[model samples]
Target: MWLVSFLGKTITAAIAAAVPSCIGPLSENIVYPFKVSDNVRALVLTTSALAAIQADVQEKVENAELQGLVQNNQVKQWLDQVEMVRGELDDIKNRYEKRLRCLGDRSFNCWSNYWISKDAKKKSTEVQELRDRGKFEEVAIQITPQVQEFSVGSDVVPQEEADLQEILRYIDNDEYDIIGIWGMGGVGKTRLLRRIHNHCKRSSDFDVLFVTASRECSVEKLQEELCDEHGFGRGTGVVSQARIISNYLGNRNFLVLLDDLWDQIDLQRVGIPFPLGLVNQFKRKVVLTTRLVSVCGLMEVKKSLKVVGLDPEHAFRLFKEKVGNETIHSHPLISSLAIDVVKELNGLPLALITIGRSMYGKRDPREWEDAIDLLKRSRLNEIETTPEEEKIYYKLKFSFDSLESAELQNCFLACSLWPEDFPIYKIKLIECWMGLGLLCAFDAQNIYNPGYTLIGKLLSACLLEEEGSDFVKMHDVMRDMALWLVHTVGIQGINGLCKRGLELIKCYTREVVGFMQSGRHYLQAKN
Candidate 1:
């Protein structure tokens, strides 16, 4: 009897020890009914604290030593590697802990204990690994965050993988030399360049610098940006700036993207080595966006890619995204009409977005109908756009202004005559242009080559889009702008006023902004 009592006491003590460990921390099994709440909470807190420390140390190692650590650094790479490992361990802990809460009241079952023990073991292993890595010391070295936000958020439009891949290929491949993304002003060249820039920075294959060329960019400004990217202080003279930028970049594998390049940029003046010499050493690349193919030729690009507008289905998708369904789907008939109007937009994304947003939040189809009508008739000036839409018109107009010659400008405006989204046959367009006396440089029958060339120039400038093999179509916005320009600038509107026997058209600049006195001058202008 004494022996039986001793054995019972021994077994009871063994079960008591196990109860607080696996089953009690797990909090599900009724068999192990003791409250070990303090122990469980302490363990959970300890694990989280360790993780926090690891993160703190990693950030310090990054910010202190690695300037662009997230983009390129051994410390960043090691932290990422450790994080992935910890993530799997975290998944295991989460699954078991969640199940521990949901487990049924099966007192005799060993399965509960089995899962609880496994979870405990995993946590222990994780904590040990972190401890071995010197987590506490590393985090304690830097205890506070220096920035207001952990990371900035960006929303990029869904881009075609093919285009991005093509860009990546060019940037990576040793075969290609200079890469140029040539398109019209508002065709998302800058956006594409941004995407490429971000990717290259993250990839860390080559150092990347992005520079924007304005209508009046100075050599000193260009030199300053290059120097800054390479960690050189500003220099006073243009030559000094160039020298600093060149000496820094001469030996490194780097990419310099000059966005919105107007004329040929002298990279030599910017302290950039010639492409041939750099290609031989570091296999670096130079990418730029411009409206002119002639600019590509002047820069001597080996590969040039055209950025075209979105397709019909994707165009409507973007339009709907901007407008939302409430405006278009408010009526069945109006939805159909909206689709047709979107088609007339000729799949230009920027125009669709601008026009769509102007019609946002309106439930009535009449507002939409008015929008369609205005879009059809008015060119650049007369259309009613929200404040944000002004930028679009400005950019599109810049492309218009960038035309090489006045003849090309007139030829583009003449395209406004065709109805919205109407495909103009090459032969027919050339004939019209021929009689307009713009294509007089080439014979009417021989107009094919020059006509094709002119069409290409217009298309490359994003003034027009290709419809098919032998025809072209202007974007609805482009056509509207053309007509608007003609009416306002061609004296057609003034001619109409003169036909009605109204004499003088007074133009005022200094009196008030955006003021025009044409119809019986409201304040008796003295011009």
Candidate 2:
């Protein structure tokens, strides 16, 4: 019995330790019940106790399964947290990439802006330089008082000497307040005026005699000129200056020569005290030269002299003298052609002189034929077909024929497009010609150079007259000739060139449209 009890106590102690380890301290309080004989009961109780412990172990296993479920829930939460952190990290990376892209675009735009600004500044500087050069050229060509020193020829034995003498006698007798000399261009009107002026200057019958050329003929310009010639300082206004001049010349006998008058004169409107009807106090003799016959009638002069061209015999004599008397006698063909050409020139003194000077050394029949042909062509092609076509065409052709280069010929012909008596701006004219591509073949540096050179050549050839600082004028006949060239040559060539230019502009516009469309599409895709 003692041995069994000792064994049972050892077993019980083992159970207590194992049970606590498996479950908790409360597992030691549990027990198993059984009834049996003393020897058998002890064996049976041991078996029953083992079976109960097995049952307890099954209950502990169920509790352990519950704990395992709680641990699995905690692990799942940790996994969810890791996934959330990964999502936040991804968002940060995307934001940084977007900001970097924007910074790159800004850097590119900065470089493009710099280049655009540089190009604009360069273009502005070039334009300013061109404008300055144009202004300098304008100042250089200004007509001033020094041009009066030009040696205008005198009429020695004019055909209308009797008429001139009669007019002078009438002026001497104070028959008319103003006398007008009417004639066509190059008909010796200026020459006659110069003769009259020289005669008046030699005589002391008048005080304060003055001569001035009326190119613009503006009332203000006339007043300014009067003040300038009479030794007056810059006056306040046109009226004041005119009044001062009238007062100065009121009591004096004066002779004034107004050359190249295009419009009728209004002496009263000019602030001259000379009465609108008639005045005897001033005793002023005003002489004028004009191409208009209506101007002569408007003036209502007491005596008017219509200056006609030289007679055939006189024209031949003038031609012979100019061509050299020796050369005229030696060549009958030359002399005959010269006579025909002069007759064709309508006996105009300038026409005869220009032709005589041009044909001075040339005795070739072929050359003479070429000149005659050109003259005939010019007459047919003239825009304003004057009755004096044979004369005017030949005379004008003589000037053009002397030019050496084809470029010079084209440049001279280009001037014919302007209207009759139109004042041309030199720089504007050059710009027009350049726009027409006339200067395309020239060197880039010499593009404007040709214009300056052509202006000099035209002036030297007497094709252009400098009217003022920035104005040049061509003769009526020369303008007509230019029109003819435009209709015949420039229309066809320039029109084609303009069409090509338009096509090129269209092509560039199309390309720009395509580029713009592509840019818009790219922007849309990015958005």
Candidate 3:
């Protein structure tokens, strides 16, 4: 043991004499020129002994100033910083493992869930790109659209504004679950409902749905519309549809507007939860528009509002807007005649706008004079061969007559086959035209172009109004005109068709021998 100690001391002294004090910097080996061997072991031992000897010699010759310069308060601070960085690194490693586990865990079924996979991939790509660009201080934000904006302009009747406020108050006061808007045809009930719907949509508190319940409204259709709105998929039966509606609306704040309801809609059948009060769920309200005041009682509307004519001042303003300002400003004489024409309309919104637009760009006072006389004749039921015509029907006829072609006229009239206030899908309308041979084909154009062009013209003329993206509708009064034209005014030679059943068979495409036999049996039974 003493010989080993003496050898170690002698080796340490020889190394200390050979190397300079800066030998501490050469401890890292740049190359491993030697493999494992006895010489390697001896060299490592000698290097360790030299380090110990150097420490002992520094302790014996230590300068207090040099030691103070080497380490002061900074040593403790450096240690604290090192500990904090180590803790942060450990925290980062732990979070990385947790995230990996979250993605890989089998219990949550993350692999099968499309939304989960989509989110994970999307976030992973986003984080990688962000780290690539070194955008640590900023993060990407994604926004989703839930509420729709109301598209009505500022120019509105103060009455409509008042009506809107009253309607909101009705819901706010919790006064009723359903409200009714009743008006004469073309008196702007639909427009009023649109304004109210816009208000509900702008506020993010409720789920708002607007359904047009035309004369052909059915429980199944209402359910289908509601289901489509809720994205519940096509349910099998009425019961299933109702269940879907209840699930979608039972826990949410919602408003449903049934536009142009011709009759009482079965709320329960359509899955609108009634008797509005509930223990914990949000509020639901229903608003409907109709031409019949009795529909209010049928629908059990707790509050009823009548959409009356616009006041004279608003009516004239609306008329001027329909006619260009340039036309009205061309002459003071025309402006005075325009007021007289609008006054003749008696504040009826539809008639005023239609007539005024028809008179647009006519600077002649004589044309305005002619319109006033015509409007008076129509309103008094004198212009028609029949005496029972409504004023709006004639005014709408005037809009119809302004169309560019007779083909357009035929198209507008063809829409009458659809039920009154019923929405006519553009595609279905074209099919109806082709089935009836109403569309005239040209070589260069496709077969449906004529019908589509006519539809656009009608929509621009306001003879046909859009209900939703896919459908268009004739105003109820316009539909009335169509029914009158087809069934009443054009019914001259159709009464004797029963006597000429054989001739009817010739025009019919398919054989109906069963029908002829049934007729023979009915005749014999009657005899």
Best by TM-score: 3
Candidate 3 runs further than 4 Å off: 1-150, 278-281, 330-332, 380-389, 419-439, 445-453, 466-473, 489-527
Please give each candidate's TM-score: 0.46, 0.51, 0.60
lDDT of each residue in 1-527, candidate 2, tens digit only: 44544554565566666675666534423211000012122333433443354344434433332221111333334334434433443443343334233322221232333333333333334333332322211111111122132235443445857656865775676567677887777777776776676566556455433444444466776666665554432335765555555655565677776776777667665555564223565577777777776777776665677888888988888877667766665566777777777766777776676567666666676666676666666565545654543346546567666766656666665554444445677876676456545554358766677787777767755667676667677765455444443443332233112223235332222232233233331111100
Better of 2 and 3 by TM-score: 3
Ranking by lDDT: 3, 1, 2
Q: What overall lDDT goes with each candidate model?
A: 0.59, 0.54, 0.61
Stretch of 10 with least lDDT, candidate 3: 28-37
Residue 202, candidate 2: alpha-carbon lDDT:
59
Q: How many residue pairs in model 2 have overlapping backbones?
A: 2
For residues 1-527, write the lDDT of model 1, one tens digit per residue. 44533554465466666666655644333323221222234445656776776677655653432222112234344456556656655665564455443223222234544554455555556665665664332321211112111121253445544576788888777767688898765566766887787777777667677777754455766776554444453445776566556545666787888887768877888767665424556866788888777889988888889887777777788778767887778777777777866865666565675556555666777766765665555355544553432334543454475577777877786666555445678777766566555676545566468877888878766577776577787755576566545544441211111112354333221111122213222221111
Error of 2 at 277 (Å): 10
